[model samples]
Target chain A: MLHSVALKTLHDQRRSLVGWVVAVVLLVLMYAAIWPSIRDQPSMSDFLDQMPEAFRSLFATAGADMSTPVGYIQIELMSFMGPTLLILYAVGQGSSAVAGEEDRHTLDLLLGSPVSRARVVLEKAGAMVLGTLGLAVATGAALVLVGRLFDLSLPAGRTAAAMLHLALLGLVFGALALAVGAATGSPGRSRGVAAAVAVLAYLVNGLGGLVDWLRPFQRLSPFYQYAAHDPLRAGVSWPAVVVAVLTVAVLVAAAVWGFGRRDVRG
Target chain B: MSSAPVERDDAIRAEAVIETHGLSKSFGHAVALRDLDLTLARGEVFGYLGPNGAGKTTTLRLLMGLLRPTRGSARVCGYDVWHESTSVRRHVGFLPGEPALYPTLTGLQHVDYLSHLRGADPYPRALVLAERLDLDLDTPSRDLSKGNRQKLAVVLALMPQTRVLVLDEPTSGLDPLAQQELHTLMREHVDGGGTVLLSSHVLGEVQRVADRVGLLRKGRLVAVDRLDALRARSLHHVHATFDAPVPVAAFAGIDGVRELSVVDHTLTCAAPEASLDRIVKALGQFPLRDLTCTEAELEETFLAYYGRGEDDAA
Candidate 1:
């Protein structure tokens, strides 16, 4: 397990982890606080209804009632802002795990010990999972707190389920970044590749519903499984959860294999 | 060559701790290390001397299992470096030329973390080494000076108490006093039956502690022999200024003098140690005003090996 490496890596990232958690919590609270004002405006629903269907679907806000607390939270937090923040945090942490060590010329020192290469990669991936999970839990707690204070009557179980899905979604990108880092000992290239994948996947999922040719390929996108089911309203989808977990597992395995085979650059 | 006995007999009797057979490494089309054959006995401090980019670092990295060799093989403690790297690493302690530490970690934290990874208790040894090197354990590594960071790296590499120590340019950033202290520590380590493979471009540092040295040039092993023997064969450049003009033929018949030249009142030539007495006697007959003899630098000695071809190498 290389417990010491994972623990030390987590310890090193504590400051950045705390900063990200605070940002996610504050963003969730601010959006939840304004939900009452939007619900109070009666004509806001008519305004949203009159808007173009293509525009609403493009943002993954279609079939969501803006006046309701759950609908507003899904669009503002879970669908867009929350995932964006978590993905950024996850990708940054994952890419830096291996490639950053090489960049700083510290990988040789670590590998000089008796630890196996596979253990090092696996332990770093474990640290990334723990960090993203912390962010997700903090975001869920902040939503629950704001919901009670504002009397939005948010469902606690469903919100927790949404946070779990969000965390898994972040894990997929984190593992992808880690895989890229292991393949090439370049942090900038790893981050660029993972970020590009995320952006392209999001676009395909967003525009899939309107374009006929893209609709068939939407299921291939992780974002489609992430937002298409609306876990906040209908609870967790087992198939989607399976796909997310499988993606994380496959990417992490690839990272370990790639790292074990390559030469460690000094 | 001097026939004085080497100080340690245990080193001669000990089994080979490190051995390489036709070891070669190339990056793309550029060869970093050529087909090299070498061996180091247990409890011996073997100095690896070479110029920059002369395959010193490449050889160390190959032994550490950080880079795979393109041909042949290297072994540590009788285990192949690439096939049984974990076992090799368990027995070896290494200090890289450029030591990189975690910026957020303090020196003490780094020690603890690395110690934990090695699955050993190094706290006691670490504290003692830190004091010897005059390093602040509480300072963040990023905030420490280069010499301090080097001190920290030395502490980490030495604290593990492994069987073999591979140090590459270990004294690079250390002050003179600290370097002296490190030399004392290395001698003690070898005395206590630990094998050391030290690679450095600094010739004097290696000459002080090494029992024998292997000279490398252009990725090839040019020479390997006892330090005293190599020193005996080294040539010195002699420049003598006389009160009157002297004939170049006066130095021609000296036992080990060569390339003798006379320009006006000055005479210059290369002389080996064995011919020093004859040359001094010959110079005394003339009116000598000023005389200076400079011992050949390590680089010059290395060039001398090439000048005479591989047959003349000890």
Candidate 2:
């Protein structure tokens, strides 16, 4: 089964994956724990309201209330830190899927077996998806645990929806990285291209609301689809979720096609 | 002896386990393989001999369907390599010149993963191979020495019990004992009616184990002959110390003799196997004190072929 490759890859990544999950969970819990202190200070909400619109928009908290649990978590965790960690994790795994095998000179041995090139690409992509989903679940669980301990009254459905969006967002970058890796057979190049896209998209989405000129290009970034509806408060937007899913599908198809046609150079 | 005709027919027929028809591969403008034709019969060990950059690895890649040929075609176990690669792979086992393994996986895990990929249970055979090769399966592949890594690769390729084995420099990093064990394993494999395409630059190893050898030079096959036939055709250095002065002319103009010379009471000549009787007859004319005839090594024979142009090779 193609899933066998995914299982094997996941097993190989088990140790490092635990570390990433632990770090993400700890980061989430640490941020969630501090929300109560900030929520108790009425002066803090006044200070946030007095802040310049441009400065607030830069952090994606312009229209949202800073004192509320959903608004605070969106600004401090979900909007930037959580999604960034998940995207980086997915991109790392996706880029390593094909290009890493070539870089390590292990692709030849793997392909020498009876497995098809398409299966290899698809299976590795499957592994990346699994890892990204695992990260999302870990982060979501941490958020829930800390929210309950701190009495933040976080809505369970909205939190799950937020995690679902985050996972989809990670899938977009992961699939892109996989596609680039398949075409180039170079992990460094794949990572560079994916990271460049991620950083540029992030900046365009974050700054688009603050600057009038960048607003037109904001929708072109995947971060717009992820953050536009604010899934942590409004629950999942089906259109944005569909877009993310379709983008991942297209990129994964490209990866499998490119990998099937190219020579196993390494 | 009674199966010779049947085996010959099997080799010529479509039943040849591994066959290539004018297979060629080019990397952009540089040709790696050109108009190469090869055939291998079941239960035979065919050595593919060449120097570096002689397309030995390229040919193996083409047969494995890792590289598509620019022209013609190749088949393993009667399946076209490029078109039906999965089927081809199902019947053939391959070991590359350098075996690269997953670093984090222990030797046992690597075996398990590969076997899982192939949809076969290899543990039993793997255990036997580990014992034979003296491999430690618990060690991480990253910690294994080069020789151990090679042993792991060998076990992976052989454990599947595939019909054909394509091994490129299979003994490159093996210790002497391990190398001997590999040769024994290959012999045993062939004895079980398996075919092997063994590619290497080591002439002595090929000469020791291969029933037939194909000498490749500059991406072209220079010669493909049985070991005995190649030995017969190869030049042998003959040195004789005579009791009396023997005319060098007596050894000249003989079939398969070349570079005849006489210095003092010593006579020296190069002769092929066909001229042995005639040379002995000529040497009998003089009272000889000592004589020695050394057959040219396979390396020297291949070197001679390597020095020849394509036209000469053809």
Candidate 3:
């Protein structure tokens, strides 16, 4: 029954999902194809060293010391491509969960059914997780292909873990979006709030990585818990996973409880 | 048409499909419904009559578990509207005043989605209703006209195999032929021992399908009686044109007569019932040119309650 609901949601949103998937795939291919040629330049090491910490924080860690043939792949894929993919999925899924229903005026229709309001939110969120998971798998395969063609020695376990980490991060954002969607009950306002929150978190996470004062504020952002390179390539952060899980749980619970009691007349 | 009288108590029996006790709902300073007590017996086609903003839609929404009441309570098939909303929702088929359906989906998809939510595949009934109503299943809702949208809503509400129906202005957008079809459909449902609470502004529609009518003014039910009884209570306006000026004094002291006016050579009398024999006999002495009589419409009686300032502000 749960799967049926999720599948219904997917079929309802199949057009939009297909469009996003194609766009993401093309984007990944373009970046992956263009990135291999930039790895061979002699000035690459000096350029990596000269790069500002803030700029480095925006994408991934780039440095002369880590400038091996494989390091080029690490700096580009882990820092830049991975987080961008994660954020895109997060924003897309999060805004669509509640706001999409409001847009279609199906929220009232859905609520009018035998299903509980909590189940609607959870089911849509679950569908988003599945979609993001699919995207992650596609991105991982594309990354592996790019690595092989470019002669970049990418660790299979670490790369797969990174993709999984990104997928989980997307879910966190998606759940937060769901909460916003449920609370506001307007697609435009919910999407705006979710975007603002996601962008703010990303900024805080970036600044914390670059500056010392903002480091303390880093704990507040969900991104701080998702250190892409360290997790997949080096080691896993159990604390970060716990914190992410807790954040998702609290937001979703609050959303469901709030929605359950709300007068869903609209 | 006279048959055995149905007891008022049994008109709404214990096997009632819907019951509300003092169900009051208010939006901030505006009172939508106040002390609303309603009961719909099994197999009865009930009409809920009220003007715009008379809390008709609000009442239906509350019954469907779409809106929670501010005070008091209601039960659908013995299931609490607020506490056990899911159970209540499962058994009730609701047609909102303006059903905001998914515009992109075809008529078939609309039925499929609604049935899917109810945890039942309502394809057979949906197809039957669509064919009966002449709704094109292949066409998307946006492509359909207002009447078709209403048809889709009706199909969605009726397709579900539920005993109780809470329909609000179900036939508002349909054409005359479609309206006739809907009336036939509703009667069939009632004959099959299904209950329906149809809220509508059109009295003729209600009179045709509803055995009992509940007249609502503002947020309160002013009259709840048999449709025929309610009609019998309304005044009939009779006008008589004489060849010469006629004295209105002869029609005096009549039981049902409320106001009598004579202008030029015409005598106009507004009364609960036209005393045709007395009126004609009295006019025998005079040269009566023309006589026309019109019974008060149910809407007029409804307006009379409201027009007299009976909670018009509500």
Candidate 4:
């Protein structure tokens, strides 16, 4: 039954998926076609090093080897692109699942069926999970092709782990959006709030990376927990994985509880 | 003051349906329901009648477990709305006054999504209902007109084989033909032993199908009676066209008879039930060519019950 709902969500959002796919293709081409020629440029890190440490830390991983092919991918794409795109897609998709129902006046119709509020919450979450997975898979495939073409001997598992981290982080963002949607009565307000939360997550995590005192505060932003540098250079951090899993579960549970208590009269 | 209690009056009972007792609700200062009592029998076609703000929609919302009542309580299909909301939701089918559907979704996709939420296959019944209602499956709900949106709401409401149906203004945007089709489906469902609590403004439609009617005004139930009883309590006017004019004096002595008149070889009189037979017997000797009797029906009686009178303001 849940699979059916997920499929329906996909079909309903096919237009959005198409747009994202086109954007992803263009992004992959830029990394594959444009970035490779500049990998050997000695002046790249010299130019980046001139920027303030705070700004530099926010954009690229510290100690990253910009002279190599795989390191260049990390510096150019995974540092900024991974979290930003996932955050955008997660907020846009997840907030609408519930709030969009209110906007369309279909909440009454859905509630009137033999459907429980909890089940609705679960189905919407399932759709977001699948969507996040699909995105990770697409990005992983693009990275694989680019890695081979550039003759970069990067291990497949590391990039795979980074994509997994991206997807899991997207799931967490999606859950936060779902909770916002459930609490606010108005869809437009919920979307606005969700977007603001996403931006805050990015800003805190980004700024915390460069500043000495703010480094401790970065844990508050989900983006800090999902930094691909550790997983991309070393391996998946089980502790970070645990945090992501726990936070996603907690947010989704709160969303279900809130939905259960309130009146869905639309 | 006592009359024979109607033998066929069976108290409604439902094993898995929504029920409310003395349910009352208010928004800030506006009272929505006041000590309202109702019983929806299993598989019974119950018609709810009320003017605007008469608490009909509020009652349905409570049954759907959508809103918490300020006072009193409701149960759905033997499930407590407060304690067993999930169970209550699983058995009840509801249609709101103006259904707001997802504009981006096609009719098929919307049904599928809702069905998925219910943990069931959503499209088969949706397909059948669309066919029955003559709705195009390809059109997005946003593009559908108001009437078409209403039709989609109907499809959603009736597609589920729920034990209880709580429909508010179910026919507002329907054309006459669709209305008739809906009536037929409702009657068929009731005949198959499914229950319905239909709220509507059309009196004639209610009269044609309602076993009993509850009159609500300003969030209070002023009258509850069987349709026939309401009509019977009011005065009836009889118009009899005879072969020849009968003398008015012939019916003057009858009790509870008034306005006896004979003109153009026809006789007419206004009387209650007791005097009706006597008046007819008095003119038995005359050849009766045409007789047309008109009763003060439930509609007029209902209007008069709520009619504004001089004393009402005072």
Chain B vs. true chain B: TM-score per candidate:
0.86, 0.88, 0.86, 0.76
Give each model a TM-score: 0.91, 0.91, 0.89, 0.80
Considering only N, C-alpha and C atoms within 3 Å, which residue pairs clash in candidate 1? none
Per-prediction backbone clash count: 0, 0, 2, 11
lDDT of 3 by residue, B36-70 (tens): 89888888889999888888888887887767789
Candidate 3 residue runs with Cα over 4 Å from true position: A1-3, A62-85, A209-213, B1-14, B140-143, B243-249, B263-265, B274-287, B305-307, B311-313
Fraction of true contacts retained by every candidate, in order, equals 0.69, 0.60, 0.50, 0.65
Write candidate 4's Cα lDDT for A1-266 as tens digits. Answer: 22354565666667787677668756876777765667768788688778777776677765666777667777777778777787678766778778777666767776675556777777778888778778777787777776677665467888888788888888888888888787665666666776777677777887886677877878877776777346777768777888898888898898888777776655
**On residues B1-314, what C-alpha lDDT tens digit does candidate 2 reach at each position?**
01101123333444689989999989999888889999999899999998898999999999988887899998887778998887688777899888799887788887887887787554578889999999999998889998899998999888877778999999999999999999999999999999999999999899989999998888888788898888867878899999888787788878878778898899888777788889998999889999999988876665554445664542
lDDT of 2 by residue, A155-238 (tens): 888899989999999999999999999988989989899999999998888789878899999888899888788788788999
lDDT of 1 at A197: 93
The prediction achieving the highest DockQ against the true structure is 2
> How many angstroms is residue B182 displaced in model 2 relative to the true structure, after the best TM-score fit?
1.4
Cα lDDT tens digits for candidate 1, B76-131: 88778887787688778899989898887888888888887877543589999999
- Compute the lDDT of residue A237 as modeled in candidate 2: 96
Q: Given the true complex, what DockQ would model 4 score?
A: 0.36
TM-score of chain A of each: 0.95, 0.94, 0.86, 0.90
- lDDT rank order: 1, 2, 3, 4
- Model 4: CA > 4 A from native: A1-3, A150-154, A209-213, B1-18, B28-30, B101-145, B234-300, B303-314
